[model samples]
Target: MSGELRIIPVTGLAEIEEGDDLAELVAAKLELENGDVLVLAQKIVSKSEGRVIALAGIEPSEEAREIAGDDEDPRRIEVILREAARVVRVRPPLVIAETTHGFICASAGVDASNAPEPEMLVLLPHDPDASARRIRDRIRELTGREVAVLVTDSFGRPWRQGTIDVALGASGLEVMRDLRGTRDPVGYELHSTMIAVADEIASAAELVMGKLDGVPAAVVRGLEVAGDGRALDLVIPEERDLFR
Candidate 1:
């Protein structure tokens, strides 16, 4: 048998709702195993609990006018972008920022897709790691099975042409599998084999979820977890980041 782990998108996950048992809802649709990880879109999680912000009433502030392009500054768009962004990218028209929870993403990871109205956009949950932890705990509580959970959001890469999904928050899973001192199939000691497993899973899951497919959840099975508990420590911080 092949040893490679595979993640598959769980289709038809129906829209998530606030106060909904997220774990139970996910577990019901698919048969899960011990090492399987659940990849959840931050958008859906934000939506289900009525986190979608109606921008119609929001007014743009001085920061918004300065941040949002002069031509692109609609009052509502500015408000949502402002609240979501921790840092702003000034060179490009987009807001490349550290999120409230410290995820470095465009517009502080604020998204306009799947928004309720034409004039509205949605912001990510204030605390995604906490959000992931809650979901993981709830799933364990309801199904009595332990599994990893990751909240995902899309981000644009520097020096790259397109955007991709990335893990914003995760729990009950180790985000990275460090193989720094390990060896490859050959006897060569690996110095940089530490893999970002959670981000990889998020990207794979999005391949099936699609930007417009409305699919929000995906299952990754057969992979060995690095261990259990939250993986917020695995990510890099802005100050230490050399790429900025």
Candidate 2:
């Protein structure tokens, strides 16, 4: 049988004050097997990690007013700074960033949407890989089965305006599948042929997870991948960055 994509809505899971047995919660809801993968949105994890703040209480700094720069939304600027401290690089309206994850992104991935509590904001997890490991371990303890867990966050491409999901942290899955030295259809040797299988997997899960829906967790099965907690290895840096 082929692999499956099961997008399960996590209802009443909003006030996630602490990390739960995510893998087990997802597995039990989906009746997963040993090889299943759990794809979770970073928002819930951030909330659980106390990464959320009541934005209403946060005052916009003078720097934030300057950053806003005729945008006329001081709150947006403050939110951006709180999400990202110290701008790494900027180009007029757009500010490319060195996010807290060390991942470069626009707006530092500080999203304002889907905040369950009014006047509240969400931030990304401090260490997504560690969070992923914890969830994986908890799942293993609960079900006595080892499974892969992927911490996913929505990110915009450098030149692209739209957002797609990316794998921020992962375990029990290989981030890249190098096909170098492999033969092609014409018997030509392949070179520089590492597939970013991890990001692709994350994007696929996001297709079902959706941006506007309450369904934040997706159960992905049928894909066989080796996880080594090397999600960052897949991140293409600048000079190496196609957008730069």
Most accurate candidate by lDDT: 1
Q: What is the C-alpha RMSD of each candidate to the true structure, in Å?
A: 2.5, 2.9
State the displacement of the C-alpha of residue 107, model 2, in Å, after optimal TM-score superposition: 1.6
What is the C-alpha lDDT profile of model 2 across 1-244, one tens digit per residue?
A: 2555554444333435655555655666656567777788888777767777676667889977776678545665677676675577765446656676678777676766776576667777888888888888888888887778888888777556798888988888888888999999999999889888778888888887787766778767777785585676766775687544
Model 1 / residue 96 / CA error / Å: 1.3
The sequence of per-residue lDDT tens digits that candidate 1 reaches over residues 35-146 is 6788998887787666776666777777667656666655644654566545556543566776556667766666677775676567787777788888888877877777
Model 1: worst 10 consecutive residues (lDDT sum) = 84-93
Model 1 residue 215 CA deviation in Å: 1.0
Indicate the residue-level lDDT of 21 in model 2: 52
Which 10 successive residues of model 2 have the least lDDT summed? 6-15
